[model samples]
Target: MILQRPGRLAITLAIIVSLFLLLPLLAVVPVSFTPKRFLSLPEGEWSLRHYRALVENPAWGAGLWLSIRIGLISAALATTLATLFSLGMWMLRPRFGGVLMGVALLPMVAPPVVSALTLYFFLITLGQANDLVAYDTLAGVALAHTVMIAPFAVVLISVALAQVDRRIDLAARAMGAGVARRIFQVILPNIRFGLVSAFFLTFVLSWEEIAVTLFITSVDAVTLPRLMWMGLRDNIDPAIAAISVLLIVLVTLVAVSRALHAAWRGRKAG
Candidate 1:
């Protein structure tokens, strides 16, 4: 068990790496409280001015709201489509599953610039360009996010479905259960964790997305990250740091909560 031991060298190396990764974030958190309008290491006085400004600014608030709404819509659409497709692939074991999965994964694997250009051209050709139905609309942004995140959902859900015992399906069939009943009563309950994980992963991906969003959206449908980009161009402010801190905290809380829930459930089952 020497490998498991907290040897001095290993502990020192771990701490060093952890601090290296976290230093920027740690620096940002305090800067978010700086009294100065510009970003800097905190000086004589720390203040909540930046946070207050973020909350009070209409443009920032609007962008935040739009991002949240679009992220939720995109996550839901991606999760539903991915879950259904993954389930179908599992049930049928069609030869095309490999091809379909590969196609679905293209959005994630391809360079963002290439995908954005292709999608832009495709949208324009379909007569969606510059119209409400075309680029820059909230719906359009959501659709793009859905395409980007669905493959991740499909991958996670497929792994979960693979873990399921095939005999369970046979048992349900032997009991004369219809498709709907079997899915809801047996399959869904067993794969609940997978579904939840897929939902969270897809949601987080959409929420944090920037590259494709940048190419595909404009002022009307601008998201939080887009707004942050604008802020970067105009000025460096503590508000941007505050927003980044908020996002990091939110994602951390979500991940910890999911882990705790899974642990509690396992304990209960035992």
Candidate 2:
């Protein structure tokens, strides 16, 4: 048996890259359990004082609540609008559809920092033009998130919509299905996977959003990421480390559970 040198080299390189990316994340696990006030691994003692702080501190809870609320709202808004737009574009198949698609995708390609600054100015102008509440508000933040997240949903759902057979639509039309009925009965059911995927993907994006959130929110609207950023500047408490560890554990469990479920489903299908 001859060993494949290239295959072995590629596997070795992949392992090195994975460890380099993941070792920093693992470091936080030990740092969180330290008895020390700052973020360092304990020599011999371990404590949950950092984790306890999250429960004891009202700010942490508020930040978490705010993040969830904003993430849900923004993600739903982005998914809904993107789904509608993608479906319309697919059905219409306009002559300038390519141009429209390019515009829809601009948010993702544009520089995030530049976009954040531009959005900040737009929010201020919008508030003043309406003679209503001016910038640094939840509404502003949500709007920013919606725009930032919509491009991803549009791209994903469009691919799914394209995969759908066009003959199904013609059959629905011949069967006397109205526009709305055809959409709900035919188009949506076919693309449910893409819709679900878009929602979860956008939700995760909004949950981890910090750049635009930082620019938009001023007071009483601090999201978890923003709070963590503030903590980094103001304090070095292991509570931040504890929070990091919690996030790491949750993500690991979710990924593992998803993989197991997929494998089980594959076995059943087989």
Candidate 3:
């Protein structure tokens, strides 16, 4: 079949857009390899010194670990709450579902400054100001992130749940299968991919979150991005570039793996 020429322009435009989106990341990878301590294009030599420094530095290591811990905890909390909320919305009436979903999405759609200010004030009033439960505490940071990312989780999980075939539930009911048994044995298995995708997305969102974390966390509970922000303020170091490169690589790998898994599952399902 011959394609129309008009569509060719759209394809070309898409390629250009993709390249534009990828340029900064492409530039960063090479810059991470620069031998100079300061930010610059690669000159005479390329070195892995920055990468080495990142791995060997205690502060960076601790910050990275803290970020990972917080991200995992927040993701788990968000995923659980979102899953239940989405399920409730799906099972209930349209008006109820719409209201619940809208409330869930409020945190994500609201202005960052508003969220930061509100949380700061709320925590202070709750007597968490200088205590372990205060702004800089790990629990506070995790809770803030959970609230921030729950909306996204709900949206993703709702999509997954929407894709589920209602007939499966009907059939199970016809056979006298209980709701718990049906959900565990039939529904979850079908939407496994969506759940996995939701988990990864939630995790990544929590991992990359900086705005709320920056305002809510102190030195002891500072996340990797927050630490990087402070480090950049003091100096422009290649170590930051190295950390950025590592993060990019990690996220890319996880995304690719999810895509491959989804593809493989699709084939198997077909």
Best candidate, lDDT-wise? 2
| Residue 19 displacement in candidate 1 (angstroms) | 2.2
TM-score of each model, in listed order: 0.88, 0.91, 0.84
Q: Write the per-residue lDDT of candidate 3 for residues 167-208, one digit (tens) a residue.
A: 987899899998788878987788787777788888889988
lDDT tens readout by residue for model 1, 199-248: 88888888888888888877788898889988888897679999888888
Best by TM-score: 2
Lowest lDDT 10-residue stretch of candidate 1: 124-133
Model 3 regions lying over 4 Å from their true place: 1-16, 125-133, 255-270
Which candidate model has the greater TM-score, 2 or 3?
Answer: 2
Query: RMSD of each candidate?
Result: 2.9, 3.3, 3.4
Clashing pairs in 3: 136-218
- Could you give candidate 2's per-residue lDDT for residues 1-270 as a string of tens digits? 997567888999999999999998898988888988777878998899989999999999998888888788889999999988998898889999999999999999998898889888888888887633347666667778999999999999999998999999989999999989989999999999999999999999999999887787777678899989888888776889899989999999999999999999999999
| Native-to-model Cα distance after best TM-score fit, residue 227 in candidate 2, in Å | 0.3
* C-alpha lDDT (0 to 100) for residue 159 of candidate 3: 90
